[model samples]
Target: MLPKLGTNETMPLQMTVGLTYDLKDDYKDAGLDPETIAELDSPATIDGLEAALRQMGFTVVRIGHIKNLTKRLSNGERWDLVFNICEGLHGVAREAQVPALLEAYQIPCTFSDAAGMALMLDKGLTKLVLQNHDISTAPFAVVRAQADIDGVSLPFPLFAKPLAEGTGKGISPLSRIETHQQLREVCTTLLQKFAQPVLVETYLAGREFTVGLLGTGDRTRVIGIMEIAITDTDGLYGYNNKTDWFDHIQYKLLTLETEPALFKSLCTLSVQAWQALNCRDGGRLDIRCDETGQPCLMEINPLAGLCPGFSDLVVLAEMAGMSYQALIENIVNETLHRYNLPQPRQRHEAA
Candidate 1:
């Protein structure tokens, strides 16, 4: 049970927090595609996360990749909690390494636990989990190869992409298939090109936004919903869009104008997804509207980005009136609270 804060009492000195992210050095051996590795070392995301934590007065230490991450923790390095940002080394299980290590060490951390990471990383499984819970997700099917696309029952105009990669690795405008033959070709490309299962889902062709949820359980807070305006690009946030293809001339961002009804719905769906996966600390839940403007789950990003200016989560935080410091502080406190760490008495502005 969480401890109730008593008035007129000082919390103790804050516990040390550690940080880990995919390193530039590990890019080659991380088993990711060459192009993918380049983006993994983008520094903007991991460095931004560390900078924010340091500003919160936490003694943040950065470790690179999963190579020896587990061994290092076993060697008596004490951390009250780990801020895990490892997207993974290779395979669908990549995102699960950090949390699994931390959990084995009896140390707490932020973001989704190992199982949640595994489930969410596999988009096909994620959809099934949501469907099993009766949560409305995009209608979808899984194909192991191009030949397996014959019996897909999803509505026309489907989206096909690698079911397990992140950062929009294999997605492109070509991923959108309007006919059965097109769908088969796309699915085959994903399977043969990536050697992974392809996820085919009913495309939601409306607004794109992410719901930022922080903390967990009874105290979880919805930071704010961020709308993605991809006007300069084509219709997809595919590999090219992520790589800044066409310099974003076709991409643009739209304003919700702070629609109250939409905001509430985004919050509700994000929280439901978070709770369904038993996520803790913070994570990002992706939502999209159908042609009729109804919100549905697109996917959940357990390891959301923290790029100083580019990350959607930080962008949402900025809009929600949270400085980077406060955002990091909240994440730290939430993690500490999970393990019942004694609260710190003093509030110091970290340099």
Candidate 2:
């Protein structure tokens, strides 16, 4: 059972939570492409999370965008804390925007801070950080413009993706470039489609996994590792595959009990990346095996998707015997504890 606070719990102030996120409709209004809007949090997610917070004795407020947040907080309005999942509409620093604002206002928020989110979203920079720390990741280079791709040499059978994008954006089977022409075509396409720099890395053709992590530093724990069998994804976990994953793909618990060494190594590397990136509260890491049958880091998501029944992170936790509510509670409780506040017991109303 999760730990609970006692009657003598310190700092017993009634909690109020501010929920912030970009909605799909918000993107529609701005004339963003439907595919791009897929990154935005669904209404059901906001509702489910708000209901959970209310159930836990928190008064909740919905702040949809920076404009509304500015109006409220500028007028001296504030919540005890903010539950932020705002995938900003544009820019490489999109994921960090809300958290940056929260820090400036001195209001605590859930998940990672600005620096952590920024680092995780930038794939090439993230790999560099991991390499500097001696954590194994695929060999990679970045292509900012078409000229940069000229005479480029990393390796054959390379993978290209947007440097800063989530929800499988800018990724497709065509992302795997086996020749110079394919590399030039895909990188140029990604640069146009996402309007961001492209990351070109050595392709890891082995099995892929997404690991859910909770807490921070020594307290961090691997919730579970989810094996993603991209059966119909043309050998790549591309955009369509992720969007229609339930229909076309398979999800499985991946302990690799027979290969205990690989299993243990996956867990260890995930925690290493989490700590190296200074991730707090909770997050997810994408791990893929190298040509040598050893697991290597791909990317980390400090701002992991939270689509209730649909998100892979939630599925991973469920595979490990945790409910969606419990998964959310873990994030909430971890954030509270980080502030040195006692956790409230699971609240139940009178029958």
Worst 10 residues of 1 by lDDT: 249-258
Give one digit per residue, the lDDT tens place, for model 2 in 1-351: 112456575544567789998888776767777787888888888988888887777778998877688888889988878999998876888888899999998888999999888878899889999999999899989899989997578878898999988778888878888999898899888888788889998999898889999997778999988888877847677778888887777888877675677779899999999999999988899989977787889999898888888888888888988777788888888898787666667543110
Q: TM-score per candidate, in order? A: 0.87, 0.94
lDDT of 1 by residue, 1-351 (tens): 123446654443454667777765566654656656644556666677777666666666776667666667667676766787887657788888788888877777788788889888999899888888877788888898666799898888788888888768788788878998898778877798778899888888888777777887877778777776676546666566655534552323223464777777777777877888888887788777887898889888878877665666776777767766666667667777777665443253311
- Runs in model 1 deviating more than 4 A are 1-14, 28-34, 38-41, 245-257, 345-351
Evaluate residue 155 in candidate 1 and report its C-alpha lDDT on the 0 to 100 scale.
81
Give the Cα-based TM-score of candidate 2 against the true structure. Answer: 0.94
* Winning candidate number (TM-score): 2
Clashes of each: 16, 0
Cα lDDT listed for each candidate: 0.73, 0.84
